[model samples]
Target: MTKISVIVPVYNVEELLPKCLDSLVNQAFDDYEVIVVNDGSPDNSQKIIDEYYKKYPNIIKPLKKENGGLSSARNYGLKYATGEYVLYVDSDDYVSSDILEKMYSLGMRDNSDIVVCRSYAFSNNNLEKIDNEILNNDVFKRYILNRPSATCKLIKKEILLHSELAFFEGHYYEDIAEVPAFCLYAKNISFIDDYLYYYLVREGSIMHNKKYSDKLNDIFDSIDNLTNIFINKNAFDEYKDELEFIYIKHLLHAASLRFLPYEEGLPSINKVCEIMKEMFPNWSKNKYYKKMGFKYKIVCSLIYKRKFNLLKKILKVN
Candidate 1:
């Protein structure tokens, strides 16, 4: 079997598609295939995809489907993947060529089902490497607790298949719903400290688009789906602490911060807090909550206390 299948879900990224494709084709590794799935982009993305496929037919495996959003495109690409392992890449972003070679090697050596590499956040002309100290199975809960996005991670395709997992289609913040469940299914994991993924932080991306702030409601569905997934697997209590942290981090704190920015954001923030109250009412006693930095503790406290005005003012001041 091929070492890896790099899944690139393409959308309307005509201008940036070449850089993403170029990065993959020039990888130092050769035992991988790039599954570039175009999601009916209205831009010139398909033409660019076709040109690249023509140039490197063996390496570039192209799949064209209707516009079904990122999650749908990923599910489509994954359905036909023929690799022992899978790695996801966004067409608007790129990755270090050495990523697959290094990650794949470690995955095989350790027989780890999930391999993580640090990601570089690029904006304007600056590149900031983001991540913490190296991790392993010792910190397994951390995997499900942090960095919910599945982008750039090398995962065993069997885990996805056996788990019968698919990204929650048509939902915003699908990563929140999907990534933790994937991590839960991982029996072994590995991490690389190197910045192997380039994450483009551009304006108008899904997370940054404030005009669609109402869509933050989708995060609720994502969180709820995760809860159901855990229950179905009957692994809820085994990872209950991590699950609580997911609710606190993704729904309460992260969503509140997003809503705190706008004029009518208080109601949204309130909605997030209400969910936390209903689901994880004793969440303040969470172990990870005790380990959070002073600033985050303050933020969580304010949110828990339902202090919307004070929380907004405090966040705005910073």
Candidate 2:
């Protein structure tokens, strides 16, 4: 049986796909299979995938499907992933050659349901490692909730299958909703401090687009989905505080985006603030709010006060 399955959701990243696939092909660990999902890109990405599939016929399996977003592509890939553990690698990002060996070793040793490693951001032809401490359940909840990207973690396949966890299809910011659910379902989790994943930050990416408000509804829907999951599992009381903190943080981020000197984001920001108040009527009194940094504290205070004009000015100045 394959020890690990690395799933790469290919979209239109033709230029960068070679780097990503090359990194996977050269990994020190060989007991893994690579599942590349071609999400109906109009570019030469399929040809590139064909080249790699031909070269590594035994290790690489390519799945071609219609244009579903990242979430759909990943969900489809999961169906054919017959590994004990699964890792997600974006088409535009690459990983260290030793990452699989290191993470898989630690995961098996610790019997971890989820194994997390440090990541680096590659921008402007430079790579800077992100700093992170060791993680326990308490620390993991707080840390993963804040940085909810799915790329840096290795999850047990059983956890996903048993919990019926899948990403929200056809949505932006889907990771924000899915990663936390994975963390909640995970029992024994481990972390390594080594920088194993390199996340590329480039223009025209889904995250770097200037128009943030277009996906605001999807973001809120993700939050609601998470809430429903917590409730159905009867874990709401146990995770209430953490969930509340995450909701508030997401709201503040949306609120800050409204300061982008665009009118389209204003209504979304207003709706975010309204939902924040409705959900946590006394949010200012929450312990998490009090422990936040001065900048967030001010933002929360201004949001509670409904001082959008002043908040916009303060955000602009900063």
Candidate 3:
């Protein structure tokens, strides 16, 4: 029988980790092991991990490591995993009881390298389900042209090994870079329509930090890394536009935040524009770029400087 390894990276999610673990502990499938890596969390996360380890010793293996961020924690967990397939679960997120059974069954039955399912986000008062079309569409192209999150997917361990793929350590947007490449290398994929994962949206999370302001060069640097991977793989020409569009959208969001006035923001915005010109010089002619209008342009113009008060007067950021 094939086994699945669930890699969950633990951090300072003491408040929500219990619910996440409870859901996993009760999974309908039994041929699985949960590899929990504690990424130097300062809270009571260690205590919780210890409790679970004692209760489910055979299924749960706990490893304590220094703070190395998300990518590092995942890489650490990968080494201890013994399952034929792997699924990544965030410490603050939970999964449906049947998620493992369904994902594993589908992957093995269909001989697929990747198995993807629908997921939803739970906030204070809202729940948003990701579109179901992902499981039905051409996953590789959709993945390249759209939002690609790894949490809702099950991947074959061999593919990662064959491709020598590991999450880029020390990076904030590792998934935003790695998941697509993994899919591009995939030969077969299976899709399940069920909402198998529950992603918690919490403030103070690394992804939600407002301090992740736009560093124009860094942003371009990351995009270039992914683009080069795709181009070298001999992916379609369509990827160039898709990659550029993705960066442009990121730039737009970073620029639009409530911050200092245009004067402060303009430098970053101008820097983004410079990168965009280098990546997609014809972006101005693209319908989406043209539709951004003056509001977006103004926000970009004020990315970094000492004009906070002026920025607030014009936009309701955050």
Candidate 4:
């Protein structure tokens, strides 16, 4: 089997596909296969994949399927992954040339199931580490109660299969819905604490094109999926405080702001307010709640008090 299966799910990313493939082909390590799944893109991404496959037949493994979302493409790629460990990379994003070698070495050294590293945002020819926090307990602090992107980690194949770490299909926040199980069930988890993955932050990206609509409600679906994961693993009681804080962070704060610019989104926002109150009435007392900044604390306070109109007015002025 290959040492690492580098899965790249391609859609309409013809322009930036070359740079991403270039980084992978020049890796310091060679015992790896690049599974490029073209999810029915109407672009030249297939031709580019064919060119790379012709040049590197043994390294570039190509697959094609019907038009599926990001989660579907990743799941399709996973079915063909034969590597000891798996790594997901977006077609529009490029990684450091030495990333595969570095992560593989660390995973082998510790026999790790998951190896978490730092990620940077690349835009305007500049890069900055987004989650550079140095916490006491690294993996839990990084994956739980934080933005868990599937692109930022190297995962063991067995642990994934054993725990059924499949990405939730048809979900906008698939990583947040599925990533916690990787950290929670791993026998050993390691941290590189270095920025190796570079994600592109620009307009028209999947995250930047946010609108106040039913799709935004998928954040709540993600939370419910995660909550079920914790319950099935019998971990909810132990991590209830962290789970409660997630409700406060996602629904009351971040997801609430998605509706801030649209007056018609008030009904859905009020529904979210009811769920938050019913499920986590004592959320303000959660210890992790205090870890947020002053501004977020004020916003959550407003949300908890059912002051949507006043909260909307206050958020608009800022």
Top candidate when judged by lDDT against the true structure: 1
lDDT of each: 0.85, 0.81, 0.73, 0.82
Instruction: Give the worst 10-residue stretch by lDDT in candidate 2.
Output: 253-262
Q: What is the TM-score of each candidate against the true structure?
A: 0.94, 0.91, 0.82, 0.92
Instruction: Kindly give the stretch of ten consecutive residues in candidate 4 with the minimal lDDT sum.
Output: 132-141
Minimal lDDT window, size 10, model 1: 131-140
Kindly provide the TM-score of model 1 when superposed on the true structure, using C-alpha atoms: 0.94
lDDT of 1 by residue, 90-123 (tens): 9888988798899999999998999988898898
What is candidate 1's local distance difference test score?
A: 0.85
Give a tens-digit lDDT track for model 3, residues 22-73: 9988999988999999999999999999999999997888999999988889
Candidate 3 is scored at a TM of 0.82
What count of clashes does model 2 give? 0
Native-to-model Cα distance after best TM-score fit, residue 104 in candidate 1, in Å: 0.7
| Off by more than 4 A, model 3 | 132-137, 162-164, 210-218, 236-238, 252-266, 284-315
Summed backbone clashes in each candidate are: 0, 0, 13, 0
| Model 2 clashing residue pairs (backbone) | none
Better of 1 and 3 by lDDT: 1
lDDT of 2 by residue, 1-318 (tens): 799999999998999999999999999997999999999999999999999999999889999999999999999999999999999999999999999999999998998889888899988799887763323357556555556787988999887775447988988778777788786677778877799999998877544566554665678888888788878888888877777777877665543454334566666667777887788676667666566679878877776666777877987732
